[model samples]
Target: MAAKSSQTMTIPTDAELVQAQADLWRHSLSYLTPMALSCAIQLGIPTAIHRFGGAASLPDLVTTLSLPPSKAPFLSRLLRLLSTTGVLASNEAGIYSLVPLSYLLVDGVRIDGDASQTALVLAVTSWHYMEAAMGLADWFKKDIAQPVPSPFEEVHGAALFEESMAVLDPECDKLFNEALAAHDHMGIGTVLRECHALFSGLQSLTDCCGGDGTTARSIVKAYPHIKCNVLDLPKVVDKNPSDGLVNYVTGDMFHSIPPAQAVMLKLVLHFWSDEDCINILAQCKKAIPCREAGGKVIIIDIVVDSSSGQMFETQLLMDVAMMVYTRGRQRDENEWSSIFAKAGFSDYKIVKKLGARGVIEVYP
Candidate 1:
């Protein structure tokens, strides 16, 4: 029998121990960053600074926001944190200013008049999401055979998309749609610029699970010759009136999709499990023609790559967010390829990598 070797454990030096403590503390309190940002948004701090010609002193903000004088010190602390986190900029004079990050949070200032991330921030930092994130520890303690699939379901008693938010909370429903539209607007520019060739010769296209026809409208505007359709559930389609540009079809992608020369699934598959993704892609396959006929499914989603530095970290963060919110996860190249192959796709091509997400062309 081989003798087991005993490994000696070296105690961390004082400096190393102190550094480790700081790192641990940073990770432990990292949730405060988003919480502070959310609080700032709720208080209209970004807009207030924008109103002050892009700069506002502490007194200027308090006066403009009509905040009580007693809370000025507390507000100052919040601003300090926000400035430290790069959400806003602060000068030595203690005047707060909008940085590029905070500029997007200001109302009515859209990137190319398309969308602002204000809605996305609001939706993500809402109570329900925060509660689910808080419940993650307890969720992990559950047995493998437990009925609950996610922290969100554990808290809310149902999957997020199992029923329309319109039925559950009308305000949240509106905010959620706006959030998706905002996100799609931010990414659509990259897709159109980088993957223009994918849509050039297509006669018709379908945007599966498209929310509010945001991406569809952008596509139609870019390629006017191609007819565009937005496929979604009735709950989502009914609220969005036709603008005479893109046709909105009430349908489910898992069951069937309207036939098109090409199809696009923008940020949709990440919300489903692999089996569900395969089912959805198979339906997409049935909707489009063979690959030789210029038929393909364009997917704009996060393709996790560990070597991509900050982008990889963002992907991992979103992966955990998915774990808390749904049964889905962000996939790497191999995982994505496996799903595509299982869905009967013969081949696929990654057209471009747009920051944390990628534009993929999956062939039938």
Candidate 2:
């Protein structure tokens, strides 16, 4: 026999092994939870509960939902899963109630008309989104030194925006726009509410890559004295009606931006690489007055905070989401500083009160 081996493998204890396996299984099956939520949305569970005085027993939910008798037990199981997952509330007597989170799924409920379809679309698990997610493994295996497109591009053979505009799926496009509107509403709401001081002195502002004038309209609505302009591609601008409160101008942001005292790029930089962002910022710099004339770039995006546990996790999740969808990322303050420096911005300030995101004022 060979020389006696001194090394021995340390095996996990039975309980440890069992717990590990359970955790793995739980993670593996976690996809089912979102799928179940999607199914519930499809079955009008949120609407049913809302219509039933915000809480309904199984039989009452079945009646309100118009479900067949045979599916009651199965629906009950689904509800139990949703309740356990905190999507809804369930009492000891088997009644289901809508939570603030679940209430987002009810259409026509939002007065501001900024309610999101993302929750519903994500729950239904859009094929394009799912395909990109499934491609993550192959994406990781690619050479780290080599250039790469986003996982979404690797799957669909085009960037997310390019694919969305080129594709012929009307329903998908509508849902996507609604989802975008919802997200924009939330982010812009935060900026306009918490960062009003940033926009107060500026007379004219341009929203580069602004979609349907959502951000611009919100800004003008709050501060009517500030003239707002939105610059986007021709296709996006052609679809929306001209709101008297905001001007929608059609153009490519890479080549040019509308001249303004301040340029607001709300959630725009996160979709591009640093190089691309530098190019865009260069164009933005040219479009605005000098720093003494109240010229600056207002960026509303995630500034990753690693100090907080849950916020850090959410920021990382957004980073992965950006990886799957685009060549961008959720930047930390240092990364943002680096990008700003490269883009010829002399100084910047950050206001981090907007939940997981911040308003970064970049001066030229």
Candidate 3:
């Protein structure tokens, strides 16, 4: 009877222990944390407190957010998690104060054109990211098990570029464009400071995939001679400029890009698979003059394994993001070189050690 009980035991044996250890990944899946965070931002919890004259007590927060009396304990638990993340601060008496990150939640914080929060909201719940999250486990596997069976293919049943057109609801487009520009602003600031030489001898530059002209405007401000143009979809330019400096041109980069001494393609190529990148690059090659005329493509993107420093986990997170959103894959130096060659480019130089990104000068 004792032996039979031992044989039927529910507790793990040594092999089962190893299997359970491997399966512990289910606990490690913490994306729900950020999803919850996004929900808070969407609910304008921080903005409500700001309107309430800042520093909110627990009871005050409950009232402001209008929680039911029955869920009071659960609401406190949520607040505790937000506090632990430094998104919201707690006073000595346990009243919560808004932090810098929370300030992003306030709609009218930027008198000019601060679009950071809008982008954040779009990025978190975007279909691209949702599809990628659906394929997260497939990223770990060595082989794709089916025809056109990439993790992205599995989720979207199509390529990234296809979905870009499919995701054409007006509200979503606004959020996505806002996020794109806000993200570019951060990347361009770092690129301008670190890779200034890449811009040398270029009389004008066009940000081909630049949404709403954030990076181009910054460039035109910094270098008065370097006239900048922002080329994007018709919808992107539809809203008349509120406060951007560079002129906006509605066009497609795949067929034609505006003429420039050098074209800046930041965070664009990674959205396309290599074939599509080649198509875009071939157009870029046509848009500019030869290298002697300072004709080149200034690419600010990740060359994933370039012997650089610590990558923000966001970088790797985005690689999987590309896999789901488009057929694109983030490349290392070798992979980038291959794409350049495929695009009929001669040579390229990479300069790393920038802020969480790499700057590459690709010559045609």
Candidate 4:
């Protein structure tokens, strides 16, 4: 009787078998989500629906997108998939409408030029990124002692920051830059508005590794009295000439940062390893004044926390993306504290949470 009971327990129940199959299918087919999203964005489906008063029927989308009558069925299937994925909404009457997510994809919806997330989506879904993602499994199988820094480097034969993409495809480089600038604009705008106290008395600030002076220009716009200097590579600063408001300085962050009351490293440190981050922070410490003089380093990056539901999930996704593209990983609070202490920072404070990221103020 005991043996028979054990055998019965070993056999999977009907419900357990069905659930296991469902879980396997869901995980296997997860790649289709991004592919479908990319296709919808490329086809300008969001813009088309927006043009039709943010709600459109099947025939309306066909006419607006200039699809042939024969392709109407396929378009319907695409819309149905998008709706199921929560990218859009559909009613029993077959009318489709834009949800919050689709609004960012509509052309001209953002007042700030090129500040929408559309370019970012396109850049991430581009061929190079997809190629790198496909190579991640094989990259894991390689010897750990191998010098292949990341899956992207393994696939592309060069690091992401080595200007390999720019050399190989100028258009991709431009798109990626645009995406970064857009994200900077959105993030900095929020920080300035919500955390005004952080920059209240700053007289001079340096934007370390600032790309094309986007963050500097925004800071100058918000606080005209603060003298903003952007430090970056010659290739970046040369193209973006000083607008006479923000000073553009051509230099490397690893060696030195221009003197300032405060130094800002927005989305810069995460691309490097922990040791490299410490070195960069040391440079930042050298650039600022004593803590008593309101000198600090402002960092805007992800602070991974499991308590935050969707934001935590997004952070994890970005952490893996970093693993694939760079040698960096998003740090939790304890990890960040360890790095700060090692870098000779006297103290640090997480001022606020900005979506999936956070504002960290490190004092000398």
| lDDT of every predicted structure (CA atoms) | 0.88, 0.82, 0.73, 0.88
In candidate 4, the residue pairs with backbone N, CA or C atoms under 3 Å apart (3 or more residues apart, or in different chains) clash, namely none
lDDT, candidate 4, 97-140, per-residue tens: 99988887887676443446778888888988889999999999
Count of clashing residue pairs in every prediction: 0, 0, 2, 0
TM-score of each: 0.91, 0.89, 0.72, 0.92
Q: Which residue pairs clash in candidate 1?
A: none
* Ranked candidates (TM-score, high to low): 4, 1, 2, 3
C-alpha positional error of residue 37 in candidate 4 after TM-score superposition, expressed in Å: 1.0
For model 3, residues 102-170, the per-residue Cα lDDT tens digits are: 776776666235634746664757665576576767765646553334565565454333444345444
Which portions of model 2 show Cα errors greater than 4 Å? Answer: 1-10, 118-120, 142-147, 163-171
Top candidate (TM-score): 4
- lDDT tens string, model 2, 247-303? 899999888899999998888888888888889998999999889989999888888
Across 136-167, the per-residue lDDT of candidate 1 in tens digits comes to: 99988878663348898788765665564566
lDDT head-to-head 2 vs 3, winner = 2
Clashing pairs in 2: none
